[model samples]
Target: MPPRMSDAVTGPAWASPAGKPPLSSRMMRATWRGLPAKRYEVGWEPGLVVPAGDGSPLITDHYFPRAEGDFPTLLVRSPYGRGLPWSPQYGLLFAEQGFHVVLQSCRGTGGSGGVFDLWRNEAADGRATVAWLRRQPWFTGTLGTVGPSYLGYVQWALALDPPPELKAMVVQVGLHDPYALFHAEGALRLENVLAVGLGMTYQHQGMAPFLRATLRLQRRLREATTARPLRGAYAAALGGELPWLDDVMTHPDAEDPYWRGASTAKAAERLRVPTALITGWHDALADQTFEQYERLCRADCDTALLVGPWTHTSALQQGWPEVFAESLAWLRAHLHADTSGLRPTKVRVHTGGEDAWRDLPDWPPALTGTSWYPAPDGHLTRQASTDSAPLASFRYDPADPTPSLGGPLLSRTAGPRDNGTLEARDDVLTFTGPPLTEAVDVLGPVSARLTVSTDTGYADVFTRLCDVDEQGRSVNVCDGLGRIRATGHASSQVTVAMSATAHRFAAGHRIRWQISGGAHPRYARHPGTGDPRVDAITFTPVHITLHTDSTLILPSGPPLT
Candidate 1:
């Protein structure tokens, strides 16, 4: 049983001078664009201590509208510190809109006590926070959770054994599986791992330390990523040794006991709480959001999805106006019991190339599958090739691995990027279709089926879907990487799931299928020796051959006329 409301010892409230909005709050309101002026001034209470399940102290801050009414409460648990963007964006902004927001730091972060163990402590700490909330005089007995990225993961963690007060949830650019974030197919996602390591190590210390760490990573990323033995290679860039980082980097297999219970995807399988999901086309966890939505729909749970043209970080920065509005609307409908601001559609996606927002009854909306095959002279044709020869061949050298420009990443360099210079490289093979006579809208999952043989028998295939403009500049849309082990020099048929997209390929633009051995740094260069990436010391160069029978599969509306 939980303690009574009066049993908790809450610290003093920290109001702004004369109950006025701070400069940062004013700036956020101006820059957030579409949001109207807040209805009330926000009151803040900082440095409140809540007890975790194991009696450890978890530091927290409270934000509320300075009005005379009882409002629903919102819970946001983040590993990132309670400062700057989070304090202003979620704490003050949402509170001013008539909700009591409790912004808390997970154990071992933001002055909280105890060692942070990634996904292990979240569930228990969340339940303990709610137990504390139950004793707060202003808790209102109604609750909703809201946040982005790892913060979103905390929401799912709490949902695993949600309290009766938990009613609504908003997950923005979120990830459910740490293993998937680090390893794709069989290759390690080197860049994302390093970026995450930097954040986990320094972001909680302070702004100065985090900025310095970011610069350090920027300066030494190449050295760290290209190191001979991959294990412990990121220590210089990340500041120091992180045992968890070393553990995750070394364990490439998902089935290993090390990764057991890492994924929180099961929480959504039968969730009854109303959930609102927001993601970007280039978000690292966009596919996870889609999978969550699918599971919610299958369970007949109320859910809404919003996908933008922004990246994981941009979904909160450039795309915040839409993301915030969607979140607020959902919270109001569920927690406040106000449906006036709800949209009529179940899903809203911003279409690229067309630069317009489309509201649909569902995502992937009953689309047709269009198949494009590779042909001679670097062309992509609608008909299959009967030629009995290899379509193209390229040599991949681990020493000078293919550079990854863009697509999906956690860093600022994510999203669609021009592949002109990259396409000019000998290691990349591109087969382009003719100029589209009519517009082609790609609205769902994209895949590449290829038959390829490598001299080393162990290699990775990087496939990308690109939109080529009149100037011959190819911009990547969605892409995927697959690791394959061939048998006795026989060609292997590998299908790479390039994720999904909601984009328009305007008339006169061309569609291209780009293939390469690997996207270095984005994915660790395959050593070509079938050894674990972290322990492999030998780097071998391999010749790869692509057969003409390969095809690109896209989900679209109708075929080009």
Candidate 2:
């Protein structure tokens, strides 16, 4: 008996006024109808289960349509509640599509009965959940997982073990590495941390205990006007055994234990199942996704990476429809269904400024060329010319640190929008290139080479790559910051890594590089002292120098004529 399409499948709610139905919902329904009809006779039954794990009892909300036959299952394990509108929508969509959807609440949050420990129980619990699903009568012995962010994290974790029943996974904006994505360049990304924490608080509601504790400490510090008492209270509340925070403060350098737990680079290589890796250029986790894609490619795993011109939230609000459609197509192809029109072994990137998409065989087209070096007198030339004068110097003060006007700072409302405001500060030095002869598309890694000297042993170097319009308004294309300790500096040239961007510098648009000492609160201000954490509010005037031979390298392609 083939499953009959329900009225809900044909209603306006499922299909838009346009001829095409909503991708997300329609795909789910289509998957259901595509399954063998005999399974439809067996209805689904709901249940909950606690996996055998160390942390807490897992709570799984099952949606098996009471039918007569076994059906393939779709699993979504989330820190967010299983009953949330989004979760149910996904479950219902999958169930209607022909697979039993199981939505589970992670340990300690939602309806689960255990203490939540971020990444601690994800692997073990995921395995246990899969094993449980395999035993259920409604299960057809195959399982797939899909989700974004935290949910995506679970998929990656489960894939590490190569679960027997796990067939495929769709991971979106998942945190591949926490260290690089969060505490970047040895600075506390306060804004993004707070935004994620607050959002989790609202979703889980179980974070009330931690919130109460944090609030209590905040009130105590506020009342203590004196620096000594405030410092004491703040240390007690935020310092010491706090694993996550301590990891950031202690390991100012990138590759630490804390960072290892957050990143899935190693796990990605070990994964064997087919995977769909999705991310956005505007996502803070874009670097992570790109890194994972590269790793998977090197490992010779079956994987597809999709990058769009969207932010973290935009992917879910608007991008998921397209994402889901492509995901289903991928699944159908691998599942021996259909893949007639899909393109293979190619990269599709959104060309900024032009606001159009282009397809290429490789990430950065081989046809692209680089400008040798720009001369000091604002000339774009191929020949290398040295500055007769000494290096350029700037004074960096910790107290009056340069504030981050806009960039990647995370906020409840929205992250940093544009870098236009930060370009106006005096502390930031700008070097501009003449208008391009034609449109240049830069789509990969950006690097800055600098021979620099700082009066203080410990200082941070920030570089921003931007585009200056004819009106002289500078817009930040991409930026990267590097923290240099006194011990790491010796008269040698150093390179700082900045965020990646995909932008086209118009023929008349000048390419500009803005260098500064700090982006403040978005990043913890470098006290310019040797100590990692400073208690006293001291302002140090550091003499910073950038040599004449320095260069900003852009991964650009041949001019689009």
- Whose TM-score is greatest here? 1
Per-residue lDDT over 1-561 for candidate 1, one digit per residue giving the tens place of the 0 to 100 score: 122223334322433322444466567666666774676666777789999988889999888776655789999998888886788889888987888889998899999999998899999999999999999977778999999999999999999888999999999999889999999986999988998898888887877989999998999999999998989989888878999999888888899999888899999988999999999999988989999999999989899999999998899888888899999999989998889889999999988888899999998778888899988789999998786458789999988999999988999999999999999999999999999998989989999889998887988999999999999999999999988789646788999999999889999999999999999899999988878888879989889999988989999864322
Backbone clashes under 3 angstroms, per model: 0, 21
Best-performing candidate as measured by lDDT: 1
Residue pairs that clash (backbone atoms under 3 angstroms), model 1? none
TM-score of 2: 0.81
What is the lDDT of every predicted structure here? 0.88, 0.62
Name model 1 segments beyond 4 Å from true: 1-31, 387-389, 559-561
| Cα lDDT, model 1, residue 469 | 97
Provide the lDDT at 452 for model 1: 93
On the 0 to 100 scale, the lDDT of residue 252 in model 2 is: 54
Residue 144 alpha-carbon offset, candidate 2, angstroms: 1.6
